[model samples]
Structures are given as C-alpha cells and as structure tokens.
Target: MQVTGFVPRETADLRGRAGGPLTLRYGPRAVVVVGGLPGSGKSTLLRRWDAPATLIDPRTTRLACQARMPAALPYPAYRPAVRLLHLLRTRAAFRRPGPLLVHDCGSRWWMRRALAHWARRSGRELHVVLLAVRPAEALAGQRARARTAAPRTFRLHVRRTARLLAGIERRGRAAFPGARSVLLADAVSRGRLAGVRFDAPR
Candidate 1:
C-alpha cells in the first residue's frame, strides 16, 4: 500500500506553501492536480515535474485536435470537441496504474469534483498544487509563451483564481473540497523544484 509523505516542515508548503527545492512524495496512487489562473505557469510546473506519469493536459489535446483539423479552422470553432475529447482522455487516463497528472485553471468546480470522485473511487489521493502568481505576472507569462487567452477570458480567470487563492488562504483545506491537501507555490519556489517523486512512502 502507498501513503502520502511529507515531513512536518513540508506540510507547511502543502498547507501554507513555498520555500526550497520541493520533493513531494504523494505516492504513485495519487491524482496530482496542478491549477492556477490562465498563464500562471501551471503547464511549466507540470513540464518541469518531468515524471513518467500519464499527463492529462487540455493544451496537448487541443494541439492534437488542431493538427487534424483544417489549418483555416480557429480553436473557438472546435472548442467543444476539444473539451469533450480532453474529458474522455482524462477519464481513460485514470484507469492506468500509476500517478496521474493534470492541469487546470482552478475555476471549474465541476471538473475538480469529478477528478476528486475518480481519485477516491480508485483508492488514490487527490492532491492539488496551485500556482499562485500575481495577475500581472501571469499575463506576462502568457506573453512569454506567445499564446494568450482572450482579454475577457483572462480577466475572468484572474477574478476567479484570485477568489480561489483567497479562499485557500482564509479557509485552508476547506477551500478545495475532496482534495487531500493543497500546495500553494509561487514562481520562485516552484522554479526551484527539480521534479516530483511518486512512490510508496517510507
């Protein structure tokens, strides 16, 4: 059997958040959810994790969909298809026998609930790693990546993400229902993380 692993000091990051090179040992039977505002470097964090787990990233699904669609087709034209496809893929990914990594913008309650349900049914802990960055910094990240959300959409993400961050700070674990715990990581701390390790806690 596997169990979540974190020393008392590390628990502060899991609850309070960031500091040094992170070595999270949440177990291979974990559903690690990485969330943040649009362009908040959720993707970067996942990419840096460099784990061998099944990664359920909507951006990857979107790019796959775009590759098959006509070059003239805009993303909005097939956004629903991409969402459905990504959802299906995520559902399928959970069936595998190891840690599952996913990225989100932190505004979708239904999605998080569904993920939590799946994790519980599979006897896995649902761990959330939320990237908390300033809205200006997030937008700058968006620019750095050369792929930005629509202005209105970004503004909405900012408001929702801000509210979510606040709730986590004020209410702690209560803010994220069903999640075993949450890690609030800033850019500097997250940047220092070498990678994630999932295995039986010793």
Candidate 2:
C-alpha cells in the first residue's frame, strides 16, 4: 500500500500552528497561498486582506457560475464546470507579473505540489498561510455563514484537516518546505495576529 506523507519534527514545533504569534519571513516576489478546510476562515481572511499581490480564488468562479446558471440547480451538479473555469483562470494568472495570494483548499496534495512547482520554476518565494480552526468551530462557522456546506462534505473536510494538522506537527519546517504560518480563529479574534497584515485590493 502507498503511504501517506509524513511531517518533520521542526515543522510541528511552530508556535503559530499552536495559536501563538505568527512568524512572517519572506523574500521579494513571493506568492502566498492561504489554505484551510471549509469554513476555516480562508475566504473570510482573504476578503479583508490587502497586499501588493494578485488574488486567485475559486469561489469567484463558482459564484459567477451560479449567476449564469439556473437558481434551482444544485451547486454540486455544476461544481466541475466551476472548477474548470477556476483552473483556467488560475493558469492564466500564473503567467502575470506580480506577487499572488491564493485562497486554496489544503486537503489536496496535487494542488500544493502544483503551487510549489510553479513558484520554484518562476524564481518566486512560496509561502503558506494555514488556518487552524477546530472542526467544531469550523462547523459552527459554516452555520454562521449564509451558505453552509453539506454535512458529509464538512465531515470529510474535518478528517482531512486533522491529518494536515498532524502532518504539520510531525514534519516541522519541512511540512511545507517553504515559508509557513498558522492562524487560529480564536487567536485572530483576540488580536494575537495584529502584527500581520493581509489587505485585499479595494
């Protein structure tokens, strides 16, 4: 059987991943990818984030698909189309000059590998912003939002998220092998991450 990835000791020791102050260390021309499970504040954080960067989010594509499609049609039915559009848009944006801040689902290894490869090939620094919200809190956040994920989907996300966190704790800096930081919902609410600023274009 194929084995899953393992986390290194140092990456697991990051204080930020444990709800402590996030460390921000980056070089010029960096692409920061924000990732987390559903309702883990990835979207919420990016919406208010601003920096000298291009934002790539699949939700925009999904929303555009919703606008052009029938209201009664279920989102899951058209998700493939939305994802295709998002991929197209992302590929196009990858060629553009400037830093990029990508909102992503961290559950997929392929997505992470792609971003890492692109950053390496382009001579750009790659950074990961991981949202580390608890499963129960993430579920609560889904309810607080106007749209909620299906229960089964949410459960799947929770399982993947748990594994991701475990990997981070076990792997250390090598967990992502690039600049990495973690954000906890509770910590953000308490103003613990006041030093870090991520602004979105107005």
Candidate 3:
C-alpha cells in the first residue's frame, strides 16, 4: 500500500508487563489485530505463532471452513453486518475466558476501534501488527504462490487481492492508525516494529 511518511524503527525494548514474557496475566484474553496487503504474510505469521488464538478471517469464516457468514450475501450488502457479528461473537466467546483472539483482517481503522473498545470493556489488551510489504513485491509473491493452485482459483485470488491492496493504499493511514506499518525488509531484519503506537482508547 505504499505506506510512506514517518517509517518506524525497530522497537528498542519489548519487556513483558511484569518483567516476564508478554503473557496476559488477566487471562490469555487479548486480541492481536493484523492488517496488511495480501501476500504480506499476515496468515503466515499467525500460522507460525500457532498460539491458541481465535482467528477472525472473513475468507476462512465465510468460504473455507465454517459459513459464519452466508456465502450468498453480496459483498457490499453483507460484509459490514457480518463483520460486526463476527467481532461480537468472537468477543463473547472469549468473555468466558480463553486464549488470545487474533483478528487477521484488513486492520482498517473502524475494525481497530471496534476491537479496542471490546478489549477495554472486557479488560483485555490489544496488540496491532501491520505487514507493510511493497505492492509490486507482494503482487509478485502472490502471483507466484497462486501458480500452485488451480487456474480459476488463482485468478480469483489475484483479482481480489489487487482490489484490497488498492483500497488500503487509497485510504492511507486513515485506514488503520493503530497499526504500525513495517516494510518486509524491516520486519525480517529487525524482528521488531517501528511506528507510532496507539493506545487502546485512541
């Protein structure tokens, strides 16, 4: 999404709350909102961590595994309501006490605010990670990955990804302010984040 201006540097220190692992003492009840263009490794990172997390990915919830949201609903008509319901359900599910809730979505501003509000009311911490890979690099990577799949599937994914990335670039920071945008190189090299940190209530 060509994230320019005020590129953040690596985090100097990331000690846990009480000088320990950044484990949630209140409970494993927290949320990690991950946002980025397709092929930016958002899913990869979540898979790599493999933490006991409740993921709220629309593609997964809609078309892949469970039909949390009906597939028949047109995108524009059903998206907002479905997403709201998903967030609500996910939050309520964690209310009884469970692992961290990781929402692997676009990480748009509205989504971030909703999650942050939920966290505060539920007394959970919110962590945001933005996977800011260059558009060209991401597109190339996506295309390469798609080649392994069926032609029809690959074409659909590529087209959808292009649209999503374009939306993010057009929206800019207004799309996701709580997120810390990091280039692929920086994320890989430093293994840390640099960008303005947004407190939960922001």
Candidate 4:
C-alpha cells in the first residue's frame, strides 16, 4: 500500500504538522473513506476536495430528519434510525461508481473490515484519509458548530480515535492494510489545505 510521509504520532493533531497535502488518486470506481472523531473536520476537508463523489455523512441524515420531525428532539432519540438510513444509502451509492467519500467515525473495526472485504470482492480500491485530531480540539470544534455529543459518547470517541492513531503509529501500513492510507498530521486550515483535491485517475 502507498503512504505519504509521516507514520502518525500518538496524540498528535493531523492538520498542520503534517507536511503538504497528501493526495491519493484512484480509479473512477474507487471509494475514499474519511475517518476521524467528530469535529475533526472531515466535512471541511471534503468541501476543500470539491470533487464529484457520493458523500455519505450522518449530519445530512440528521438535517433531513429535522425537517420532518421536531428540532427539539435530542439526537440520541433518532440516532439509530439515522445510522440505518445512512447505511442503506451507502449500500446504494456503492452500487453506482464514480468516486465516493464516506465521512465516518473511525471507531468501528468491524465496519472497516467489512468495507475492506467489499472493496476486495468488487474489484474496487478503497482508500482512507485519517484525521488524527486531538480530543480537546475536537470538542472545541463541536462547540464552534453548536452541536456536541453527550459526555460519555465524546469520551468513547476519544478513546477509539486514540486507539486508531496508536495502531497507525505501531503498525504503519499494516494498520489499514486494505487501502493506501494518508495521514494529515496537524489541525487543518484553509491555507494549509489549498490546492488539495482527490482527482480520479484517467
């Protein structure tokens, strides 16, 4: 698997410290999974990419639900349904190919394995862009966005994100063996990410 510079340091923010923007190109039938803790700026980076891809993000599902339901309802009450819908949409998007970007919490090992398996079986390549943001920064991002997870959930995400980072540091390419992985090493900014795009290979 191809990798950009830096094997990911434990407890490091992936926005600024990492070298230049790491670009990974793939066939038009590939899917790119952007994984990180909430508020790690996955959506922000996707916007920077500005490429044509199926974007699978839970927040989009939440906004759609909010339109039909009361905004006063807590997210926990609808999270299960939202996740189910997101999964269904992901399944459908994978059927049609161009390029796909999936914004996801990188905590689920089983789901990652499943995606790896599917990519292998379908003869499509899967790539991962891991944003290793520190937890405090992630919380700040949540606060900035005016939506935050419950304390317990936030802690869980922190733990899982830390673990993923640790694995990346320890195992390098083996950590995410199924795909070519790119690690953004510090907090991201518009200036830092300028000229970044995930163009499909011709």
Candidate 5:
C-alpha cells in the first residue's frame, strides 16, 4: 500500500504479497473512506474493523429502508430514498465528534466531494482505502454473500470503479483534493490487513 499525501511515507510493499497482519493507523479525527466496486468485499472489510469509529455504511441505511418498505416493493422502488437518507446520515456524521470509517463505492464523485468538504471544514483529514478487485472476483464475492446486483447495474459499477481508479492514477494527489492519504489494496494485501486504528497525532 502506498501512502499518498501529507503524512510520512510508510511503504507497505504489498506487491510482494508479504505475509503478516497489517493495520492502518490514522489520526483520531480522520475520515477513512473504504471503497471498491459493487460486491468487492467493502462491507466485509468494514465489518472486520472493530475500531471505535462512527460507522457509516450505506447497507445500514438500505436495510433500514428495506425493513420499512413493503416486501412487495422491489429494491428499485426505494433505492432513491435509501440513497437520500444515506446521504443525510453521512452529512450528519461529519458534525459529531470522533473518527469515522465510511463505506463508499468510490464511484460517486459528488458524495466523495461532499465528504472532502466536511473533512476540510471540520479540521479533519480524509483518507481512502480502495480495494482493487477483478470483476470476476467481485461477482464471485456477490454470489458468496447471496446479494447479487442486476447485471446492468453491476456492469455500471465496474466501469465507474475502473474509471475512478484510472483517474486516481492519472491525477495522483489531485484525484482527491482533500485526501491526506490513499491506500490501494489488492486481494493479497487486503487479506493480510487485520484492521484499522485511530491514534492521537504524534
């Protein structure tokens, strides 16, 4: 994993598939955004984190919306409402105190920009943990979890996620203006990573 911003460099050298448990440490007021393609183990990774961060996962809002809506109502019928509510909840989270660990798909520029804005205004640093996975792997992950997306929707997410990753590579630090660090983790590296931690700044 490469650390790409205002922090001291700590090269993870994960390309070699080095074996060991790894933890990402950040400031107590950091906003660590976990992102990947749909069904790319983002939720699974977030769930493994036992850090005391304020968890902000879209699944939480989506499941709540699903419960409140009629069972006959298809997901498409309430996806918009779920998204809106998730946005509102994410915005509100930035107002409260403490570290934040958010699950984002990394495809929505608007949401990321909004998060950047909040992090900047609140004197907090924004960081990203991007899980770069193959579409085939992601699809298998979806199947394993029994929560597959429509083929069309899944394709769109893959395209968007690919483009986002490309942009991050092409733009470097400019890809995320307010981001203090960007950690790119492939399957091998991700598997070795144990969790995240928030500590007082040295």
Candidate 6:
C-alpha cells in the first residue's frame, strides 16, 4: 500500500503506513474527477497520481484570456463558454481507447453528468476525489498562491473561486449518487482507497 511517489505534500506525513507495492484489484478503464476549493491541493494530487488524465482547468482559460486580450476579463465572465468547449472536445478526443482520463475541474452537476455519460457509454469506471480543507487553511493557501500568480484582484478572485467550488460540489453530490467520493486529505491519510482501482506507477 505504499503510495510512494504518488503522495502529495499534505499527505507526506501520513505515509508512515507505507506497505508493499500498490496493486489494483480491478482492471477497468477509469475517469478520476477531482473537485475542491481554490487551494485544496487538487493539482498536487493530480500530478502525484500521474495517471493518463486530461486536466480541464477553467483558470487556465482565464489566464489565456488575460494574455491574449487587451482587457482582462473576469474568470466568471469567460469560464462557462470555455468549459463547454473543453467538454465537447474532451468527449470527442476520448472516443478511442487509452489510459484512464482524469477531469480536474469544479464538479458541477452538469459537468458530472457529462462525464458520467461518457464513462457509461465507454464502460469506464468513475472515481471522484473531493478535496476538502479547512476554510482558513484554504484561504491562506489561496492568498499565498495569488501573491505570485494572480492577474488582478486576488482576494475577490479567491473568494469567488471558493464559492464556485462549493456550488459545484453541492450540485455534483445531488447528481452523482453512485460515484466514489473522498476528501483529498482524508483519502491520502487512509493510505488506500476502498472501492477504486488504484495502482502504483510502474
């Protein structure tokens, strides 16, 4: 159960129970959906897992807009259209056989439905990881990250991002009742996931 290189910074201390090499009981293709507030370490976990995953990040699009356009548009104004396009493109690209695909985005109900529909059609297993950190911790992380990277208005942007994630989670749970969901920190602390097929890097 030793996750080895697959544990994130927040989960490093919890890796003392590291066991033998990791193995998965199931062999089906998977779709890992990661959801959390702005600074819940979703990107860290995604990189650690190192699965064949597609990262559909709304923030990237916002950054792109700021880079390409003269006027910096707010993330809220541009995210929906960009997300829709990404979803359509992802569905098209994933029509063929490949490794597990992970969607690293806010877990909104509509987005979950789109993902689940693709999974069901492709006969792929779906695993949802919800990163939940304390509000204060999350805010602190957001502030620190914003200091280095944000384009404009750090505090307001972080607050909006947190609110957006909360709404997405609220909607996602109501929509996808059967998908496996776990808190990022808690799941890592537990060492191994229960229902999902998680294999170590080979």
RMSD of each: 4.1, 8.4, 10.0, 5.1, 3.7, 7.3
lDDT of 2 by residue, 1-202 (tens): 2222221122322333334333233444657777777776777776654555688988788888899998999988989888888877876776788678788877676677777777777777666767776777677777788678788887877787677777766764355645444432332442233222332221
Give the better candidate number (3 or 4) by TM-score: 4
Clashing pairs in 6: none
Candidate 4 on 87-111: residue-level lDDT in tens?
A: 7777777777667778888678777
lDDT of 5 by residue, 53-158 (tens): 8999988898888989889999988788899999899988988899998898877777778989988888888888888888898998999999898899889888
lDDT of each: 0.76, 0.63, 0.47, 0.68, 0.79, 0.50
- Report the lDDT tens digits of candidate 1 across residue range 1-202: 2333342112235333444555566676788888888788888787777887888889899889999999998879999999999998988888889888888776777887788777777778787888787788888999999988899998888888877877777877567777777877776666655577777463
What would you estimate as the lDDT of candidate 5?
A: 0.79
In model 2, the runs with Cα more than 4 Å from the true position are 1-25, 177-191, 195-202
Which regions of candidate 5 are displaced past 4 Å? 1-16, 200-202
Q: How many clashes (backbone N, Cα, C below 3 Å) per candidate? A: 0, 16, 1, 10, 0, 0
Residues 92-135 of candidate 3 have per-residue lDDT tens digits of: 75465654535454434455666666677777655545555555
lDDT of 6 by residue, 1-202 (tens): 3433242211122223434343222233555666655565666555555554455555555566567654666656766877676666668645656445454544355666777788777776555565545555555656766633343443554555466545534664333433533233333333343233334222
Model 3 compared with the native: what TM-score? Answer: 0.53
User: Can you rank all candidates by lDDT, best first?
Assistant: 5, 1, 4, 2, 6, 3
TM-score of each model, paired residue for residue:
0.88, 0.76, 0.53, 0.79, 0.89, 0.58
Candidates sorted on TM-score, descending: 5, 1, 4, 2, 6, 3
Model number with the top TM-score = 5
Model 6 scores worst on lDDT over the 10 consecutive residues at: 7-16
